[model samples]
Target: MTTRHQLALGACTVTVAALTSTLLVTPDGATAATGPDRIHDIQGDHRISPYAGDSVADVPGIVTGVRTEGSAGFWMQDPRGDDSPATSEGVFVFTDAKPPVQPGDEVRVSGQVSEYVPGGADSGNQSVTQLTDPTVDVRSSDQPLPEARELNAGTVPETYAPQGDPAEDDSIDGLRLRPDRYALDRYESLEGMNVQVEDTRVVGPSSEYDDLWVTVRPDEHPTARGGTLYGSYASQNPGRLKVTSLAPSEEGFPAADVGDQLTGTTAGPLDYDQHGGYHLAARELGTLRDSGPSPERTRPQRDGELAVATYNVENLAPDDDATKYERLAQGVVRNLATPDILALEEVQDDSGAQDDGTVTSERTVGKLIDAISEAGGPRYEWRGIAPRDGQDGGQPGGNIRSGFLFNPERVSFTDRPGGDATTATEVVQRDGQATLSHSPGRITPNDPAWKDSRKPLAGEFRFRSEPVIVVANHFSSKGGDQPLHGSTQPPKRSSEKQRHQQARQVNAFVQDIQDVRRKADVVVLGDLNDFDFSATTSALTENDALRGAAATLPEEERYTYVFQGNSQVLDQTLVSPGVSRFDYDIVHTNAEYADQVSDHDPQVLRFRP
Candidate 1:
């Protein structure tokens, strides 16, 4: 249950690049006193700075942007206008020695007007009024680019969190940022200034430094393939930002995907970073076009019925990635129409993450059943239990477990024995019905709410003749929780009591098989990282013995994953009551379409037994 868009780049790519400045301006025609004390009087009206620690000198404005890489610096801006929408006529002139300045020039600078706060001063970060060691004087050089600040369309700010009060663990929300109802307080009322955004679409996907995440108002949360539908939080669509990229060696940035737009008018400056929060460091880039058709769905076949998918294949093993095991067997045969009975979460093993333990994934389930019989589907026949080699955590030699894949010509696998792997799958009652003697086994796996976690497994098929079973799960992750917007407020989900006691011990082993057989057709699905409006899914559907198949869609299509833009539901499936209704959907293929294969967005269900 850990698919938080797994691209894994721990950090270091927030650069919006253009910071060059060797302080040059000292030419003799000198001038040092401008007047209305400009650069928005050291960017005040709040957010630190009444001249910070003062050393003030001449302050004028007009450089507009430079950044010769890493933390170099330049960004001025004072064409005029002080009606103060919480003052911010842009600043940042901290220099290094002295020499080359361009973009509109007109300078002045001086030194020591600090207020910096980048990663210091108690580090909750976000301060930057800068001017340190500065020198500059230029007073003139092609002064044109200034009327920029355009964020258009309905003036943004529909709240993305900040109902005030709540702050601490990693922090946020000590309130007072109402810069007009949120969008991170209207980007902290023009923090660091100089902005733009026009027609910027692209909803996240070109990373490894080409950075992305646009939407300069592509009609806010519009879904159905046009991108941007992460809903809830009072429609906070301050017209998406985060674009970062420093001319990646000139002309090499176009792998975009979602609703793709980025062609012109992106401007830049507004920074406030800790890795993607109010970013726009984009000095100028547009032209991506291709508004895609790849948000595809429709493939949950119904004829000759038997579907059941679950896919958290984000970590499949067998020497891993061979084109993501042929693009997850073309999303399990052209997008899940081949789910005879899948489940397969994380998988791994056969030397994948190299933890030296070598727990089996049977060549990672024989390269996804030989790439789902070379993508024409059906050859399946798999089963799992593994663990004990690494107590079931994940990615350390890739021992990830939870599995079962079927289509033995449409179900059968009774396996009847105790399928080991450190044991647990009970609820016997042989002739009284119920089942699971060890079909695929591993449930309580030496309890302690199943230690390092991933122990659910079960399986015991038979389909049409009735008696299904399933289970699968890959729980225990909210990876250290506490985030739904910080400073704690309502955050602190510190792994919701170990996923609410692993959903009450998988609801007491599914109430010990519907109290020893009572129409037992169960399911339970994968990646239950919690949410279906969580409480760890009300301890797995509390009084109802199991339910959520995304509570049956609608409520704006009950999500499958999305993060940052919300469409929340950490992959579900549940079922059980009358055991019938399992015709589920969510095959939106890969969490919000990136250059995808799996960050999990798969889920089929379908039933006709």
Candidate 2:
């Protein structure tokens, strides 16, 4: 990945105007469909096999009935003579997560057509597919999709509600709707192939959710089920398809309305009961859109070469920590020396667990990008958040997270373990509870929270097609003291061992990465909070899985963190044997200035393999 740094920060902002009703042909020169162009008419007895790329003409409907309450989805009915038709007496499912309209409300909706088989033995009845957008025509009595579906069985609790209320008589509350599904008729499919699909819908809460759906497709369908067809978008949403119908076209599938189109397929939620068991499936995908063009930049000086740096932004408080900690004003002091990738420790998130409040990590990265541009460095983007939740024991505050700051212009995220870019990295770096013992004594594991003590954060990214795994860490520090057995004070060994255990965890993580991606071009860099010669460093370096950057440093210049009259190489940069020959070496190898900014110095290594 490429990184840049500029010393100036700009407040300039740009927003694109919304698209008008006139259809602007997409870049591929195709007319965009509106609500009216997509809905189709169907008879009750039609057997809706669910075509992923199927389309229907738009039609006006009234809230005929709703199935369940608390869970929002609906059933619709065509108004008779358009005079505020009464809500239907029969029940149905409304597909949109957002409630469309109340009973008596008149609206035009476009979605695929499907038949509802009321009773067990395939009672053939046809129904209008789910509404995918709110921009559809809504007259006085008409509204957009109404009510959000919280869950079918209640594992996830609903958090927010639609902007307005449905008609008092609207009964389309709990009609269990199947997210339309699709099946690609081919194997080894690429982007633009004409594929066939059945009963699949495309929808997600956010762009990130959609991106995760795209990337995790392969892993979700690792096997063939009864020789059924395989395709992408199968594993995007798990568990429920409260999602509605699919609109297929010779062009491709339609998804969330961005100014631009993203080509993906539609698929129904996995059929739990009919399929006998819940199995991952994929279908209803459409042709591809140009993957958004990569942001352009002057390629870094040497295309294949990488400049790697690691920083320990000591106690970097999140935005909500305190006004004084709102350090966006500082520019990119720590990461000013831009490299293709910057591994940082003590990075705080902008929001706490459950979007509780402002976590500083996002803001920190934003400021870093600003600083990079100001310093005249290449523009960079970031990916992945460390899996840290600041809610330590109901402390009620957002927690700082560790993570990677990458230049999207230079690299793109390829693989993210577990496809969870929202949470901290669990498989790579961990923050678990740990007991404290300052001296050489073992922690008694007394407190329940000890097992969940501070853990390191780690993630990986690709730089110029080369894997660069950055690990940001904040190990157990010697702060809180635990009382000794029947004694008023804890021996120093107790805390030391606690920190030692933290180091051991770091050591094992490095070993584990090597064990899997054996040839991984790994950079185990972070704020270790222990000296170069300390037990922590020893634990990591002794594993043969890691070699410290200090080994590549000149004598008298390896220290990165300094204390009052006490200088130690607490912060270190390390490389694995995979990239050992990259000619790597550290910059800012000494921590001479740790007073104002942080407790450690920022280190960089420039090398070419």
Candidate 3:
């Protein structure tokens, strides 16, 4: 959850090796060029400049915006408009801190046109057109900055794909963006242009980077959780735009969550680069107001049924001070309504990221248990078999693993013979009752499918005298996969193959018991790292005897994680056919908030075993 994709935007060293032949500069840093060096010509229709790598003498324009902080630079625009949608008139003039130019100053800048990819080139991101290593002479000051281009209804269409061939060869990157046809193209057309969106609704919460995603008027894809819901591949809400604050250090902008609306207007230069598509680099940000959606806590536990919850507490460790542990415990007690049994993933060893080969997490879970008790919740007794020292692919030496935290007063671990982390568990029938031969054992831990990933931990439990077995899982993550907006159409989920194998293994284990006792009341729950509609999820419940708990909610509401502007499902609770789920909810305190404790939201399932 703490991992950020931001790249390092180091200031490039100045080199005048590509100065244009016609360029001439006086000792006073004043330079002038007549033709070809105009701002529009430098910023050609394509992303790469026609004069890229060539230092021009006098690129004349009016400074539209001045960035005084962090790799300080100023933006300039051609006073005369360019009619072509593909051609951008505004361009960034990169320089050292606090350039002499101010907004609304018409100046003649001498610089090299460069394709500077913000963050870094290794980030697998697109490049932003900019003029770098600049020397500017202010021709005039206090001139009107270009008008803020307005975006309203129908300007940005609802379609994600432009009308064309949807193959790799016909990707959006290759096409001459048609602003009138697709929303992405519309923003691409206005790249670096001063733009404004009135009365925008903040769909994504502001992150530590002080950036948030917003949707302009006429987009109805907003979710109750304050994200733009992509219903299908075609339901792309073009009104959605990311906003990066230029004034984050400014006080009084209380933290904004999902469903909060920014009133008035946000005017700034339209920017397109890495960091998940087009955004408005707003200079004049609007006021943020609460949009009425609030944090949600699951219902209180009821009699005759036990509540089970699953959460991946993002590499939680004991040394994280007391704040993180306390917040998580409070989230469980309040947001999760104190589930009787909690399945946790990514529980790092007591040493956390330290590589001292400490593979036990007793201190980690114990601290959380103490916090829970301090928060007025029942004391939870946790159990797990520490994985082989460095086998798990999580934090090295930390040996991240999945485990169970149950209210011992309401539930008790049913320990049988033969339990260890290395050996696989077998299904054995004892006195006509279906049970794991090795209670609280690892499921196929040595299997190649679990190589470097958390092996599923199986444990048999007695909840109010009803025998039930639950499997805690933390599947392979979806990293290193192609992005949806990448050149590849529909993108490839390379991580799904391992997750599918893991799912099949779990499904086979569940099927083993269902063959003998069709109503065994077994439950499989945790961070599966795949959506409910994914093939991995299909393989998990392929047997008619089991079903996913999220299926009970409306299809649009079956989400446990949010990405970009889309709310998705990654965590799940699957129960046997006879174990009907009376109540199922995804606690919404996390995932949609910037101050979230976990990237994946906790799911609570209530059922009678």
Candidate 4:
């Protein structure tokens, strides 16, 4: 199985510096058009989405709400009781373009109006319309640009009443707007132009593409599908914009926060990676360093005990050897670093034409396996992989494509029926409810490519007659900094809902194992891609399903990843409820692990079954 380490939490810290913009609003002594005299204040609790009408054009309203996502993303309500969701399409343009705005900062906005239409099956937040804004001050009414696009239902009108200079270029601040026509063209002609586009949500390649997948919970609303849009960019071509720099929208809601400013100048060059119809890029990146590797390389490596570890290598690629990742595995295994069982993420299936007549779908995995055997970890063998067949023809599919590496001597593979984790008898019951066996949990089968990605690696083994189960996984990560499950966005209770789904899947799997074998030992390992303190982890641990190893370490040593200029733990290893019977220790060596080619520091947990 291929091990893919996510770089989101690691790279998110580069945003400490501000990427500011200057707006030169034309001096027009503008007065409000006589309309219904309705005033909305953002100081109190008034849901702003349904009213803001998915656009950031010059719609008049007070700074009713200010949500600081990375920069500042908030909502604006009109004096006429018109409360709509703010988006890049219309008057809803990001101000400061950073996040987490101060509660009561007043500002003015001017731009075209637009709406958000969920792509039929594409991965991404709502596509936005064009809007222009210059100045925002702490004050009364905001002005509207004469020609903002209007959303009639979910459809956008081709033409608008062009006000101002008609030929003024419809610029936001000083950035020249690039129309959807340009993007749909995939930058054929607009390639090297410093054009600015409103609501252009730049993103990195999917996990399978560049080791990142943002988690977005589908809404409870009948139409919601329970996840964020999945996309990928080309490895050969990359984007110039720093996508990780843009903040994510809040949990469930699909609109930008009112007054949300997303301003990133298109610095020449555009590279696109489209596996299906999804387009993404991974270029123009910024890096930061975390804790160094551990000094003690030989961490309690014994014969009978099981040494386990998990790390998000942030997408470990063969520096020079592409046909096989012998070197990649060498860095991880040679220093007596091999664990009895290693769960890996971002294992790519062979994509290129059948060169040299290799039939293996995953060259990376093959290389790693050979390298391990070449090293002392020769006893380890292949176990099972999740989503075994989902593949977008070898293109980057979901951000998570995980598998497992096992040592046959430590344990022998046992038989277990194959199916989704939600159906297992031992799985945790959905939150606030009991399972009826009659009513199975919800399972939205992902794209075929997703099948190739996003599945847990499961295997059974016996350590001296004691049956042990290992489930390796790589859950989704947080996308842009928008708050989907907050007081302001849609689906006010989205954050918890996502946690419940992930929790449900994990719980069910654990339960299944328990049901089949009484008192069996279970070890769950992989790059959860989520922090240990998050609601997702809370849900998984709430049932007391597994015992965490990091909890044994100090707060400073507990973290495995960093974000928002802060460090936190995301990679972890948890044992089933029976963990109290064994003694365990967690040794993080990513700093030292970095000395190799990988970014994630491998964590070592030595324990007795």
Candidate 5:
């Protein structure tokens, strides 16, 4: 599976300077003011700190939490604060190492006020206000910690963020925070403060990175399986919060799945990171109560039904663990019910990610076929053209490509010569039927749209003596897109431009086949890496050439992927008008589970062609 980027918490040495009551020196060698007497004064009513870049001395607070790992620091909150809800009373002291303090120790800190932007400034993320290069003086120990502000459904706002100023490139940095109106502003207003949520539901499954996502408001765009549905760009769910433990690794983070509930209060400092923006670094972790949500299985295809399915077995290789291969095989056999034709994406080369000159996936596909047979499925045959070395834009040297697996007992793959990696396939008329000139060929392999990306593989199949054209695609990923909680409003999706071009090319290919024979039965399926309601899907289904099967389901059940607490649709199956009578299902065997074989849920479309 493709693991997303995370915040790298590195260690730094904390320098202890001699304690002095005199005014401190700033980075510009200027004498700084010593009186920002309260934490609320330092953290003004805006996102950026009012006293940034100046050194302040003797800022007193009670240590709310002590983080001993990853840029070791402590969070302190002033008990006595001005009666302004817009300004927070807590601040983080970046000591660069383990500070000599406990959770309840009252102390005075001297440091330079700075705005450290998570993921750097170019990432367009919001800056976190911090006190860096500190000199700490422990006044007393065992004092009471500040009361954590409770964050619940009623406390969080319905709107996600404020409309950014267009003159400043739609940036929300300079705007005054309105904690009552918008969610982002509320999170910013409580930025390094101690916060808590009671009886929260886990909307996103626990990832491998020892973190999980929970929602303060459970009813926001809820899925049937207890996940927040990210239906549209306008309804970005505002109550989602990522949770990571401040306890040691031996304490064990919860292995939570969707529908699991954090029974008690999960309290921590509200911190910002590069991965998911505002998250709670939990000091007082909650207990997990599993709601017993299991994986879902789709109904098997009936007689006279041609079932086609698509699964992105994330970066599958030959040398992977046998348990992974077995689980995947079981998902295909037991959960998917052995579809007549399965389109597999991310089938890596035989060497996996090793940077050799190898460009074949025989061992990879052969191992999966053996596993399926071992798991009581048919001995399916496979067909795919390998891409040139280092051309595809997956992990380097993986040579990830799409392939088709068909059951010979139910369907036959029509094999034709001259189908290779760089050869573009054409639609031809044969015996008053539309067929591919080269079966298992690529769709415009040399086109600039497919540059450094997986080319769509097209193959012909004969089921019940009827020819069906299938196109398997793994489009460009959304690696470079801006995040939802980023500084820019509406978030720039620059990666969609390439997917749009790819969709247009594939749509034109389907149109060409229809031109050859107007009633051709064509099925296009795979990980399109775009949403069903997005422009990419629109371009692929334009002019009524194809219809997105995902759109046929209810709005709440339309997702096949879960990303950052939002259930969405990234895998899709679109069919031509000739195959109008069909039953479609997105099998929820994965994506919602913490122990998943693949990151995406497989989608199946059964029809009589």
Candidate 6:
């Protein structure tokens, strides 16, 4: 039987000096085979394989797991492995097709050992050691497999990763693995090895992709709803692990929500991929136990209170299924209490994601307004400046932009003329009060910072005879930013630079309004696409111009979105000093649930004028 206990072996006497002297080095610095025949020797103690680019003949191992979908491969582990904790005993043999290998089959494979970076070299992702173009010879079948290594709270380290050497372009590939210190190192050491987590808690809800995230260390930055919190750049919650099934399609993958438990042991080979870094490609999955974590609903606003909310409708279009519209409408009416003014993000053009030149979102907004009305909410009136065709970077030709939905009975939208997609709205003094030059206008739409990004929509509204300036923003996304678990240490947030500039532009616009009237009722809110603690948020709230509502909540309850098992804040509502007292709630009707209307959770702020 192959097992973790049975797989441990005495240290291999083969040293790097011995292998380097005997192996032929290619022009690219990769060693040719003529070295040790074991998997540990091929993996070495570093992130990159020591025997990379080498073609070895007859490497022996027992098949531990097989993945039949999407870059199909099989992981095999040597029952007897070197005792070094830094070196992995198992490796993936990429056949690029369904390999005729089964668990418990002890086989000899001949292939070229290569280091495959998951998302290309420029993505700063760690490389996976694999045997490509393999020829396998199975010796025996139905043998006992190796015992899986248990990954629990006590095993994973608190630290995420070690600092990369600056000279090596901040790449950790050349660094020696320190499994005792870093969580990444520990995962790397066990790459492709049979691993298991017993009674693990689901931190991220199962997606349509048939994968979910779990946490072995339940106490690590736990959210109120049983999620791992990604509080800062420093604390990435090392216990989180993505789980995917290697079982046949008919066996079915579990659809889990946050706080649910995967009862019993879910065991498989630990694999690395581009999506969520290291994950367990489980051959045997645990039973999912319902823990009763449900979507949240906020208290309705009082009669005198003005409620403002922001929801990224996740590219809402008129042609979407009726259920999607109904669900979103229920979230707005029931979960969010149908706020007096709702700022909508990603409201696509009438044609949705189709590559047509449609820029107006009247039908898109009309469908949502109709849904809200059908859900027994107010007949909401909307205002927005549609972007030029394909200028705003979202689904191409979708012309996704930020817009406002105001309950006409409760609030009134000041409709000054001349607002358009490309024109910039200016703050002006009108009768000793701050007012937008063009109501429902865009804020610096033509600025270079807003190039290929969603331009901020600034609108003037009147709630209870008091003027409120609300800037609805859906800033540039963090698409190009390196992953938190990427090879680069302290992973670079390159996408933040443009967001910072956008923040500054919006802040300046807000400052200009405040300059006209010191105590202006200004509210900047929407999907900022950055965290509350980020520099982009700081830039908006700089000089005390606005206070982030998320920052005021308890640390455990601040998150409005969950990504890669970590609860985080991507949407926010920042209020100005003029709005003295307010209550904010991140209504989690989505994000945390398996059935979601949007990827983001809508946030509401209630205040009396």
- What candidate 4 gets wrong by more than 4 Å, as runs, is 1-298, 313-327, 334-336, 352-362, 386-400, 415-453, 480-496, 515-518, 583-587, 591-596
The local lDDT score (0 to 100) that residue 431 gets in candidate 6 is: 98
- Model 4, range 351-419, lDDT digits (tens) per residue? 423223222335545666776677656556654332334331232432225556667766565544543
Better of 1 and 2 by lDDT: 1
Q: Which ranking of candidates, highest lDDT first?
A: 5, 6, 3, 1, 2, 4
Rate residue 227 of model 6 by lDDT: 88
- Residues 1-609 of candidate 6 have per-residue lDDT tens digits of 121111111211111111113343444687665456788988899989977877775677889998777878789998898889999999998877777668998876666889999889888788899987665666678888888899987888989899988998787888999998999999999998999999999999999999999998988998988988889889989999999998845756777899899999999999998988999998999999999477888999998999999999998988999999999999888999989999999999989989888888899999889999999999999898888999999988788999999999999999999989888889989999999899989998888999999999999999888999999999999998888788989788889999999999998888898899989999999999999999999999988999998877899999989999999999999999999899999988788888888999999999987
Report how far off residue 334 is in candidate 1 (Å): 15
Count steric clashes of candidate 1.
Answer: 19
| RMSD, every candidate, angstroms | 20.6, 26.2, 6.3, 18.6, 5.4, 5.9
What's the true lDDT of residue 264 in model 4? 32
Look at candidate 1 and tell me the lDDT of residue 495. Answer: 66
The lDDT leader among the candidates is: 5
**Which order, best to worst by TM-score?**
5, 6, 3, 4, 2, 1
Better of 4 and 6 by TM-score: 6
lDDT of 5 by residue, 256-352 (tens): 8988998898998899888899999898888899984689888999999999999999999988999989999999999999999999999999999
| Model 2 lDDT tens row, 1-609 | 112221211211111222234442333566554323312223211112233223333344544333233334444444232221111111233343435445545544444433332223321111222432223334455443222111221221121111111342211212221122211100101101111232222211112112212211222222111001112111212222212222234543333311112244433222111211121222233343432222111212366677666666654543434332333223233333456677666655554334555544667567656656655666777654433354322223535445666667766555433432233233332223111111111112222322444344455556665555556565555443321110111112344566666666666656666666666666777666566666667777666878877766544445554322122456677777777565433333223321134545566665553
Stretches of candidate 3 above 4 Å error? 1-21, 24-35, 47-57, 69-71, 118-122, 163-171, 231-236, 252-254
Worst 10 residues of 6 by lDDT: 9-18
lDDT of 1 at 519: 74
The whole-model lDDT of each prediction reads 0.70, 0.39, 0.76, 0.38, 0.89, 0.88
Encode model 3's per-residue lDDT on 294-341: one tens digit a residue: 678888888878888899999998789788888998998888888888
Range of the 10 consecutive residues with the lowest summed lDDT in candidate 3: 1-10
Q: What is the lDDT of residue 302 in candidate 4?
A: 79
TM-score of each: 0.36, 0.40, 0.89, 0.46, 0.96, 0.94
Model 5 backbone overlap count: 0
Which candidate do you rate higher for TM-score, 1 or 5? 5
